[model samples]
Target: MGILLLKLVVGLGNPGKEYERTRHNIGFMVVEELARRQGVVFRKMFWFPARQAKCRIGEHEVRLVLPTTYMNRSGKAVWGAMKKWRAEAADTVVIYDDVDLEFGGIRVRAKGSGGSHNGMKSVLEWLQTKAFPRVRVGIGPKPDGADMIGFVLGGFAEEELLKLEKVVERAADAVETIFSVGTERTMNEFNQLQIG
Candidate 1:
């Protein structure tokens, strides 16, 4: 199979201390893990309200971005990063949380709908395409009769945090696999993973 290159990875999350470590911010967690492993720092770009860092993996230069925009407004930052870095949709990967699966479960797709995710909707709307790759880290299903927003915004319980730590690690590994191989191989390898 031909190698599919990647130049940028965007992690979707809200900006603010309160949102830190929340289920919805798993994207941020994964990217932060990648940055730490790469020994790079996330610098705030003055032009756009996002934290970004550049590092090399294999023969490709890759960028890691965490949009400072609140989750609902994430598209603007993503679109801005693409323009600033001159990145094509094909060379970018978006990572975010999905509530439809069990916690720590991961699903990677080459391209697909945003479903009801506001952050993804914003990204797809701003990018003007759904043809980009994405890594959906499962945050588990919302409890019956629970408010969706509250469920997503809530932090993991003490025990769940232990499991989440492993999930975050695996999610970061999935991103690296995408860079080393291709999204198709990443999907096949990671989509079957059951972490936690």
Candidate 2:
């Protein structure tokens, strides 16, 4: 059999204790869960805040990355990895939090517009394309008159926190399915999943 190509899975989030457990940092949480499942550890990289790991799921070789560039500047790290790995857009998957969807929900897209996500916007800007796959984790919309930034940066309330774990785990599973079965299959299987 020919050698398998390397796939890059990027989880976008800010790096710091202040942002930990925040709705916006759900990308980081999902990546952490992915690492934990694979028994891998994240280490700091000079070019970007990242943890690198090599793992095999079935017959495919995977490299998981968690960008430490925070949100707005996430593309820099993502592009860095893409170039380093020589991976194509089809082989890249980006996971991030989405304010447009309901809490504890997820949407997987094979390729589409960024839809006002700064982290995704950055990735598109750096890569110069929107052909990559993305898994969007819903954090829900802001309450009446609430500061959007504050809402995203703030951790989930006790009630929401209870449901967040299930969301994260599901996100990780969706990602694995994306790699194994392709984006279209993963989307069909995961998009209909409801969380309460």
Clashes of each: 0, 1
TM-score of model 2 (CA atoms): 0.95
lDDT of 2: 0.87
> Which has the greatest lDDT?
1
The local lDDT score (0 to 100) that residue 174 gets in candidate 2 is 92
After the best TM-score superposition of candidate 2, give how far the Cα of residue 54 lies from its true spot, in angstroms. 2.3
Total backbone collisions, model 2: 1
lDDT tens readout by residue for model 1, 1-196: 4453449899999988999989999999999999999899999998787999998777678889999999999999999998998899988989999999789899999999999999999999998899999999998778899999999999987778878879999999998998889999999999988875
lDDT of 2 by residue, 113-180 (tens): 88888889999999998899999999987788998988998989898988888999999999989878
How high is the CA lDDT of each candidate model? 0.91, 0.87
lDDT of 1 at 93: 89
